[model samples]
Target: MAETVQAATLRADVAIIGAGPAGLFAAFECGMLRLGTVLIDALDETGGQCAALYPEKPIYDIPAHPAIEAGALVAALEQQIAPFAVPRLLGRRIERLQGSRGAFSLGTDHGDSIHARAVIIAAGAGAFGPNRPPLPGLAAYEQTGSVQYYVRRKEAFHGKRLVIAGGGDSAIDWALELREIALHITLIHRRAKFRAAPERLAQLEAASGPGGPIELVVPYQLHALHGDGGTLASVEVATLEGDRRRIEADHLLAFFGLSTDLGPVSQWGLQSALHHIQVAPSTCETSLPGVFAIGDVATYPGKLKLILQGFSEGAMAAHAIHPIVHPHTALHFEYSTSKGAPGSRDAPGSLAGAGHAPRPAAA
Candidate 1:
């Protein structure tokens, strides 16, 4: 006889899927609207791709700030929503969604369930995995912990020999960033031309010049791996012309970008196109009532995939959801200055520490 497993259940006014920037901001919006929200994400942490893929990279287009690192933006967003204290269910993938608007149930693979009045799909590009290179025995090496798909910490590679594979922003960025800590860094790419930013490429060139700690092994691909006890000892490389060489290294970092899929969200029967959910531009509502999509996962004509745009969409979805969640109450739009967040009576007419005065209603 098999053991019977009991599922954990939770309830909230709104169940938000995905813990990316859009979803985080949605929690803040929902909180301001006095809606209880529970956020679910497949990743172990928030920030989605920004935190997972390029935490150290710089972002310029985010409004109000001249420049900010990708990770810093995520931190700021997290701090902004700290007052909400939104419940986060991480490291669990939503396996099934049942019921309809005003009453929905979400079940995760971990046997945890959530019952919510509304659902928001803010999953950016859905569930994503690393794109591994076609290196023989790569899986075996991965089992030994010598192969890494993502750089979780730079200091971990300190004083160690590393061979980074790929030509994209992640590969180039890590190669450049890790050069300072690693004993020696070798950037391996199949093509001489890189998909990294022009400025990054220039920096890499300058750093790799003369007696720099970095070496460029371009126009080459991984040919073989030599190791024992499941741990990688070194890697073999070959050029398109068939010339081969061996590069001794203790570890390999492959950042070939991500392989994304809609995952269980695709089985929800929502109208979708090319893996993205189709949503109304005005309300960010999906084909199903009481369900909304925002951020990179939501698509429509003239939709610009930007963080700022996703922030606006989250606010719109929150306002549209207000009527459904609180049927008896009419929503009155007020600036943060006019109606501060809850529990800020001491700082009336302001959002806590935000010193801006309330703007006149006519203005």
Candidate 2:
């Protein structure tokens, strides 16, 4: 659930620039501290890539849970932040970021403005898109859904022959996932060694044996596509040794990872490198005071690009922003179990009573 913002200029103590897992968790953390917050994202939903791209994908690294789908994890986060009744400005991109420290003004692409005392940037990979393979007639197949970069719906490929390409976890995991539903699968990679976890690699190796559902093709790179009228028939592969082979396939799923850009965020005057914002590890604060970055968009000396790490970063960012929002009050850190969660918009420590923005709706 999300609250719509109809005001010309919305105000909050903290403005979160991405409503992904990290941003969502940051809202909860800020609410826990009694700081009014507003969630903003280009996408019209709270979950970001988890809900948009790989909702069906299973995440194994989340703490406590053995395995949970990406969408389910997002839902749990939504539930965690529901009590705050946080207002969300979705489907709007923050284009211009001006002002500083205790006073910041953000202009969105939708011509709306957000006034905040502090900002937390949790934009994971910023604006991201899949890295597509350079193959002839690729656009035709892509238009026909024969060549796909995201597996949003697994049932659509049921009983269909698939050519899964890449060496990373996305390729290997999808190969293993679709093996049960796909009629046959050909896993192609330029390297024999895959970049997945040891356990997943072992599973892939076991599933690629003779008479198995998956056939592992090593040292092979995609060369061409043999198809007509946006319909795929077979895929051509080649080795550096000049050896070429053609494998029959109905569709091609290329998971070569994502090509990400920081977009307008790079021009915000914050220290950045390789499309990532530099932030202090302890406070998740960027070079500019009152501005912070977390999740995959933030980088430091040693940063692990994991969702679990993003959650921790969000807490650090929220705690750091607390003093800026309430400089007169001393923050006495306490466990959540002791403080308990805020119940409603009018509850003690809720956003409504914080005297920042009006309550839009219950999230």
Candidate 3:
């Protein structure tokens, strides 16, 4: 594999970016080996995407557990690492990564840097989000610097007339949160009907209640953004009735989509997509030697992007390094299942003969 060193720091045994299950499991493996490790994430706390995106949603495929909510599962994984003091660098974005497989430097959006001996980038696809309106010139605006993703701080958009695009969760959600800070918000969506849950939509409608001066433009599509001196001034939009209108605004916020680009690591000479990282089968190593990939971001010959599979990968990757880390450890972890006669220590507890059980939900 080729090498591209766009890092901003240097020196570490292992640096795993992302506190998702995969990265957490990687830290677990490193803990088993007593190796120094660090986990970096953009969120203010642990649990990554699950904590932010869908904490209430039930996750069905975690091994042995029939169903678990994102937050609950994250809490459990955190408990698993309670005894292992893995360093966590939270609330920052990866600015750049550079150097060879064993050693790399990492830069962040929060004006800090770290070095690592190896890195496992499990940044799930599309973190910074997209510049919305889904039109041509917005792309140019995004490239030339007239649009924004997540709000940086309270003062960034203060006193600025803003046009927020989309009716999705983030669109309305962020709008509601930032309304106090924004001068004005123009909520625009292509469809009259929204995809947000009924409760959220209703809450938004009530929050921007009657007599409230919230601007909503439905069945409209923004055609272009006309600005001067690289500063956003106004936008031209086409309505459902074939009427074109222009609106003045100081900033544009698009929460309709997400765009992700594989950083310099992709050029590592491995054949993979711009949104995904590929690793070798069986060992979880990338095309580059000593460099490994894991979690939802990893794709190999035969791999599934589930937490359970990631757990297996983390364990396997640790096993792969056992020779270097713990030469005397056995090839596999010990497991014992109870399946035997009654009164035997190996017998699994069963209610079949001891008591009657209520009917459960359909299996």
Best by lDDT: 2
TM-score of 2: 0.92
Cα lDDT of model 2 by residue, 242-282, tens digit: 89999999999999999877679888889988878999989
Model 1 lDDT tens row, 23-139:
989987887777777788889889999899778667789998888988899999888777655667788889988899898988998978888889999999989998888877888
Decide which is better by lDDT, 1 or 3. 1
RMSD of 2: 2.8
- Stretches off by above 4 angstroms in model 2 are 3-7, 344-347, 358-363
Worst ten in a row by lDDT for model 1: 354-363
Query: Which 10 consecutive positions of candidate 3 have the poorest summed lDDT?
Result: 352-361
Badly placed stretches (over 4 Å) of model 3 are: 1-12, 95-115, 134-255, 264-271, 324-363
Per-candidate RMSD vs. true structure?
7.5, 2.8, 13.2
For model 1 the TM-score comes to 0.85
Look at candidate 2 and tell me the lDDT of residue 37: 86
Regions of model 1 farther than 4 Å from truth: 1-7, 51-75, 342-363
How would you encode candidate 3's per-residue C-alpha lDDT over 1-363 as one tens digit per residue? Answer: 011123233334667777788878777666544445567777777776677655655677888889897778888877665444555767766767767655566777765566655666666662544545556556666765567765535467777788877778777766766677777878888888777868778767876766553577778877778886557889777887888877798877777666655455454565565457777778776766556677777787677777888777776665565444334645444332333332233322122221211111132
* Candidate 2 lDDT (Cα, 0 to 1): 0.88
